[model samples]
Target: MYRRTRRAVVTSLLVSSVVCGGAVVLAPAAGAAVPAASCTVTPGPNDTYVTISGEGFTGPRKLNDGESTVDLAIGPDGTFLVKRFQKNVDYTVLAVNEDQNFIFVNCKKVGTAATPKPENPQNTAPAQPGSRRDIAQGRAAGNQAGTAAAAKSCTTKPVADKSGQQHSDAYWQAWTQAANRSFNRACHTN
Candidate 1:
């Protein structure tokens, strides 16, 4: 009976040591950190649009192409409304903290299916130089036609400005505002 008891104690100690070692190994190491927030992107099959969602991603994040980065707004809960992506395009979204380390969310490569390109090409002709009355009338007519065409072709609402530069600027501003807010809140609390 004493021999059996001694063997049981030894076995228990061995088991406990193995278990504790495994737990430590599985746990995150000290100073090895994850971002305070994260994001995910749901790209449509055709790659025309993506809905981005995350937590603590409010403000602006950068959308990077190989050569350049564009600022884009993140909703309060880390959501973004994205559009105008080409089919099969791969993109990366990054949120940078003050320390400059970034939390990156890679978007899936979109497939070319389900969504189709518009059959009717948009009119790109410049407005004709004319009298004030003619110009005003032409502008009104152009707006109406554009609205109708967009409503017919797009599943999602058209972005106010389709020019990439303008869109990028808007996103930059949003991110700046969000950063400022975060800074103020942190400062006040401390």
Candidate 2:
């Protein structure tokens, strides 16, 4: 009876160790698909440009609608300087990075002085040309106009997401390393 009890105890200890050790190996896999970082943009007055800020973003990326893509500056620490933008637009800003994260924002033109129109009941006189508001609108329009020109610049470039398997090995290796580091810190501590 004594020998049998000892054998049972040893088996239980071995089983427990295996179960606990497996957890450490399995934990890192969970974070493999996690996004590295994120960003946000808010539209300014007159629907000119938006102020963008966040972390883990490197800019000079393409901003696209279905028809166009524009290059825009991305500041360090992810803050976009006060910039003028066009009114009532939605943009899909694709970050030019290994992850190919796309940031989206919708801006509506608001709070402009009413224009008088003799041709129709709705006030639609082109917002006074060369006004401060108009200047902002012009700047925004310039960005919209240049999108196609900029996308042409990217024709030879690698897509950020690396859909072609060119960088898959490297990305997976890095992701695994990061996940292991996170798992060790989360599950095993001295």
**Strongest candidate by lDDT:** 1
How many residue pairs of model 2 clash at the backbone? 4
- Candidate 2, clashing residue pairs? 48-84, 48-85, 49-84, 49-85
TM-score of 1: 0.31
lDDT by residue for model 1 (19-117), tens: 666321222345967445544555654445665445545355776543345787777555676664533334556543322233445555433445654
* Cα RMSD, model 1: 24.0
Ten-residue stretch with the least lDDT total in model 2: 22-31
Tens digit of lDDT per residue, candidate 2, span 89-183? 44344544323333333222333234322254233344454454444444343343334333454333212233533323434344344434433
* Per-prediction TM-score: 0.31, 0.28
Q: Please give the RMSD to the true structure for each candidate, in Å.
A: 24.0, 31.0
- Cα error of candidate 1 at position 19, Å: 41
Q: What is candidate 2's CA lDDT for residue 132?
A: 49
